[model samples]
Target: MSDDLPLTAEDVAEIAAILEHSGFRELDLSTRRFRLRVAKGDGAQDGLTQEWQWAGASGEIAADVAGVQADPAAICSPLPGTFYRSPQPGAPPFVNAGDTVGEETVIGIIETMKLMNPVHAGRSGTIAEIFITDGTLVTKGQALVRLA
Candidate 1:
């Protein structure tokens, strides 16, 4: 996370590690601009077992579970921010439903404070659905697109 951001990637990792080592089933944290919830799962419910990993050099948090593959169809936000489907006002969106995209394709952009971060597809697929409207606020790990 940026120094200006409320939470850092290390903060999230520490929280997750604490939750995983404790008897508590879940943890929820909230701030003026961000919210995070982590819960233990029993092999049911989509996204219930998501684990956070710290990207040391980049200061980014990745959602993953050991030995478990992430759902390829859903493209989620890396952090809490205002999501923008188009590059700018009155511009065409980066991708649309039925559009084929590569793993590194830029599907949308998330604006946090004044920093604009590009959101990638992460896996190659055809866009199936868009879950958020342009310029809507999105939370970290919130699904923004579904692939076919």
Candidate 2:
């Protein structure tokens, strides 16, 4: 939650509205000031517990119209490393929300053992969300981005 893009209650509602038919099973976004988790109503069908956590808040949608919250494909880290969302500081991020990426698209970098390794999209789809910010410490298999 940057002051530049303040997350509001309306934004939460809007995100929930978007979740209704976004073809995504679940959507998770967290920032300094906002943490949101939206899941489909019948999430238990997948055998995943519908536990939720966000800034001391939790919820589940009971509406059948929005109960199909399935998880979108996530680009995860392969090794523990420093995650960089851009090639370098003062540079544009490799990808942003709504950006289309291919299986071979380089979305970011993971620096391990002082080596910067490029991270690929691993799948072809629009980048619906990004989880890690620039220069964060990411662990192996941590969800980095959500693809639709």
Candidate 3:
């Protein structure tokens, strides 16, 4: 773990797991070769903690809702990560553009750092549009579904 050495995948995973197990919310480590950061959040599941924001080859790690407007009735990603429209592969999507959802309905899951973060519809409405494809990467505040 020297500043002059690049961290391997195992190294990063180990660090993240350790920090997560310790109930830490954030981690910042740097070396002459690379700089690494890990973020934690209390996900929508409530009480199930340890959601890390790590941007591997994606270049920039961001997890704040900002800078983008699709529709007044859009549901945005609460965090940055891979957006999965279904709970698992080859499964039906949680919702489609014309589907209706309730305030607490889960429209999708955002996968970050091996954690599945559920994205909910904050308001009850019919989805007017779907802005993202299944398994695509989504950024915080980037609208994924638009309400009618």
Q: Rate the local accuracy (lDDT) of all candidates.
A: 0.71, 0.68, 0.69
**Two-way lDDT contest, 1 vs 2, winner:** 1
Residue 26 of model 3: what lDDT?
76
Please give the ranking of all candidate structures by lDDT, highest first, separated by commas. Answer: 1, 3, 2
TM-score of each candidate structure, all chains considered together: 0.54, 0.52, 0.63
Winning candidate number (lDDT): 1
Model 1 quality (TM-score): 0.54
Q: Is candidate 2 or candidate 3 better by TM-score?
A: 3
Which portions of model 2 show Cα errors greater than 4 Å? 1-72
Candidate 3 residue pairs in backbone clash: 3-32
Candidate 1 lDDT by residue in tens digits, 1-148: 4434556654554455455546888886544445566776665643334333333434434364322333567898776668999999999999999999998999999876556889999889899999999989776667899999
Clashes of each: 0, 4, 1
10 residues in a row with least lDDT, candidate 2: 61-70
Residue 6 shift from truth in candidate 3, angstroms: 6.7
Encode model 2's per-residue lDDT on 117-142: one tens digit a residue: 89999889999999999999865567
Cα displacement (Å) at residue 54, model 1: 29
TM-score order, best first, reads 3, 1, 2
Could you tell me the TM-score of candidate 2?
0.52
